[model samples]
Target: MVRTQDLTYSYDARHILQFPDMHCAAGEHWLLLGQSGSGKTTLLHLLGGLLSPHGGFVEVASTRLNNLSASELDHFRGQHIGIIFQQPHFVQSLTVEENLLLAHQLAGFRPERRRAHELLAHLHIGHKSNVRPNRLSQGEQQRLAIARAIINRPKLVLADEPTSALDDHNCEEVLALLEREAGQVGATLLIVTHDGRLKDRFHHRIFLQSTQA
Candidate 1:
């Protein structure tokens, strides 16, 4: 569902990252391991269409990101790629449910209350649906980010440092939640993290260092 070809990214003419080639099949779950400044997050942004490549092609679900206009790319991103950013970014003014609902509403998809409730319930936070994100615990908010990421039922789920802040139990919780969400919708799960321990949990490992140009 996600692939890149000879991707080279840079900032201020300094090459920050490069991918000779990469690919992941639909429903594949991959753990991306790299050191700090190893381009893990940059690669995730490229996969999720948040960053345009300075070179080579990137395709998500057969749609070439380089070919799309800004508006079209935004629409494509919303409709197909779900991203779990390193931080849990939520609008403080909106309730937890509202924050998630807004994500779907932006994509021209009516929020499926049943699915949202189910997701929240599965994550053990259904009762807090009406509360603002700030009122929730750190764990609750992290789970909420997972909820929001999968709310649109995207074809590809890109996670960045998802397990960084979690305990052993919460790490398992988050990973399982992502597994279930990706499995339920047949989306590919591509997680980017510096930790090597994640390799044990996932069957497929994409060690980014190996793909460096």
Candidate 2:
């Protein structure tokens, strides 16, 4: 569902990421393991269509991202890509339901209140529907972020340092939540983290430094 050929990136005239090829199939859960500043997060940004490549092609859902205009890219990203950042950025003034509703509406998709609630319920945090993000714990906020990402039922989900801030128990919970939820929606999972602890859970591993990272 996602493929890249000759992908390379740099910053301030210094090479940061350089991968010639990588492919993520539909329904596959990939764990991107690497150390900080090793280009894992940079790669995730490219995968999510958040940053344009310095060189080479990036294709997500079979669409060549390099060929898309700014508006087109934004539209395509909102409709096809789901991103869960290390920090959950929600509208503090909006309730949990409204935050998700905004994602749908901005993408030109109809907001389904019931579906939003169902997603929260699926995460076992449905009780926070009426609660704003300020009242939730860090773990609860992360769960809410996951719900928002999949609310559009995106075909690809990209997570950046998802388990970085959590304790061991919360880390496992977040990982399980990501796996089960991605599977339920038939979305491809591409997670980027330096934590080697996640390696055993996934078989298709992409080590950035091992091969042109």
Candidate 3:
């Protein structure tokens, strides 16, 4: 579901980052391991179509991201890619359920109220459906973020530093939830993290070296 070749990105002429080729099949769960400056998150962004690569190409679910126009990329990402950032960002004014409903709408699908509730319930936050996001605890908020990302049943799921801030128990819980939910939707799961706690959890792994040249 995800592939990249000779992918490169640069913030300036002095700092160029090059990534190794990668391939992760549909429904597979993989871990992207790297140190702080290894460009793991950058590669994830390129794959998700949030950033255009300086060289080479990113393909997800058979679509070559480099060939898409900005609007087309946005639409494609909304419909096929789901991302969970290190920090969750939400529409603070909107209720939890509304935030998820908006995800479906943005993906060009009718908002399915039942699905939203079901997802929230699975995440153990169904009671917060009518509450504003800002009112939830950090753990609850993260669960909500997970629900929002998969609400559209994306073909690929990208998570960046998802367990860095959690305790051991919570870390395990979050990882299990991620794997379970992604499997339920048959989505390829790629987690970009520097956390050592995850090294043994995934059978498929990609290790990146720092390329800050």
Q: Pick by lDDT: which candidate is best?
A: 3
lDDT at position 211, candidate 2 = 35
Clashes of each: 0, 0, 0
Question: How do the predictions measure up, each by TM-score?
Answer: 0.95, 0.96, 0.98
Q: RMSD in angstroms, all models? A: 1.6, 1.6, 0.8
List the global CA lDDT of all models. Answer: 0.85, 0.89, 0.93
- lDDT, candidate 2, at 126: 88
| Model 2: per-residue Cα lDDT at residue 92 | 92
Model 1 segments beyond 4 Å from truth? 210-213
Worst 10 residues of 2 by lDDT: 11-20
Model 2, residue 165: what's the lDDT?
91
Which TM-score value belongs to model 2? 0.96
Residue range 1-213, candidate 1, lDDT tens digits: 788898988865645577648788999998888888778888888888888999998998988999999999999998888888777889899998889888888877987878888888988999999999999987888899988888888999999999888888888888888898889888999999986557788888877673343
lDDT of 2: 0.89
Q: Using TM-score as the measure, which candidate wins?
A: 3
**Tens-digit lDDT track of model 2 for 1-213:** 999998888876644568748988999999888777778888899988889998899998899999999999999999988999998889999998899899888888999988998998988888888888888999999999999888898999999999989999989999999999999999999999987678899998888773342
Report the C-alpha displacement of residue 18, candidate 2, in angstroms.
0.9
Off by over 4 Å in 3: none
